[model samples]
Target: MAESDSDSGNLAQVRHVVLVLSGKGGVGKSTMTTELALALRHAGKKVGILDVDLCGPSIPRMLSVGRPEVHQCDGGWVPIYTDSEQTLALMSIGFMLENPDDAVVWRGPKKTALIGQFVTDVAWGELDVLLVDTPPGTSDEHLAVVEKLKKKHHVDGAVLITTPQAVSTGDVRREITFCKKTGIRILGIVENMSGFVCPHCSECSNIFSQGGGEELAKLTASPFLGRVPLDPQLATSLEQGQDFVRLFPHSATYSSITTITQTLLRSLEAA
Candidate 1:
């Protein structure tokens, strides 16, 4: 479902929308979403994150802004802004929970309705790009979001995340099939946790089997974006909700993220 043009086929107001998905968990999918948003913001593009991982929304915590006030206006529900410049905005069901430890115990129909509202009812204002982060597997929420994105938004494509391991890529393969079936264009594959970078001496170590994500991309005929190495500093920044690329411009992980984001931008412009 490659967009014929950005203008004609896009959603009412957004310039582009990218869904960040990984078939399996623990592959740094959420972290990748956070990094890409920061990178896009750094490039001066207006961006927002719609954390559709309903049961476990981490965008607020990862952004370190906490649950913000959702103001009602003449148009609709206004999303929470994370920065002073207001270039970044966020909307998530997690913000609606009464307690952090409480679970999102809802049935299929309810989940779908909430997701639809997040897409159509929320006052996203104007956005250059809206990155949606989903839960690990392709389930009810994935289908609901895909349906809404098809009917309501002009999606740029999907950014699939995976680690360098057969087990992880195997699950991500199913995610690719899900995208194909749903008419969601696949932008590329991001190989996260490709390798480990030693903090003390900056030495590289292949703690996990390498190149599975690249191999998967090759097999699926998708563009191989780039790989993000495992770094302690990057993890700490994610935990602290600090901008890793902003604070660690010279680090390896930052370099990979910047390159991958550049690739996505180029792909979008060409499309």
Candidate 2:
């Protein structure tokens, strides 16, 4: 386990709890969560990320965050903050495993219990928003996060991520219904990896077949945030442990997702 720290404050100070979701795995939901968090922080908002993915926590790696110490504060267990001008307060089950390769082989009830602990135990301090990166589908992890966050604080809404393919979008559409049934607002739907660009010619290609996301949004009557092209720069930035928006401010992927994140902020404010 990582080191622990202490702080003071309840989760009520957090204005919005944003849940990031996907229909299935490999849709880049975690990447979206990390980038969106950084974008919001770069805009001067206090942000925190709770990686409830548990079995497949990836926020720490994408953000280049090392094992953080968990501390106790007046309110509860304090999470570790990133070492940056706009530090991102983060908490993840990954920090608790004895080794990075350790597998979390727990069942549903146990997963639920751990999620409850994350919601009530960690000291998030006062945050404008807390972004939750959930595992794929509306499974146990998703249910636990929504149930616990709402029980402990106001969950603003959900942002569903999907690739530009039926296989991906098909699953993500169900998340919208899940939000509706649970009374969680549908902030919007994001079409990620909609296309790819040839590094040599600067031309974009639809390798995975595009437009399924936009079509699904229309069919479901949900807000289509925008489509993020598969820019080579994005992967490189992530590999280099750099913020995509900060490093590739003018890329299509940056422009597309930033707009969506801004729209999300507006929705949170209105909530």
Q: Which clashing pairs does model 2 show?
A: 3-69, 3-70, 4-70, 4-71, 5-70, 5-71, 5-72, 6-72, 7-73, 77-123
Q: Global CA lDDT of candidate 1, please? A: 0.87
Clashes of each: 1, 10
Candidate 2 deviant stretches above 4 angstroms: 1-9
* Residue 203, model 2: Cα distance from true site in angstroms: 2.0
lDDT of 1 by residue, 127-228 (tens): 888999999999999998887877766677899999999999999999999999988789999999988999999887999978999999999998899899
- Weakest ten-residue segment in model 1 by summed lDDT: 1-10
Clashes counted in candidate 1 amount to 1
Q: For residues 86-178, what per-residue lDDT tens digits would candidate 2 score against the true structure?
A: 358899998888899999999999999999888888877678889988888888877888777666666778889999888888788788888
Which candidate number would show the highest TM-score if scored against the true structure? Answer: 1
Q: Which candidate is the best by lDDT?
A: 1
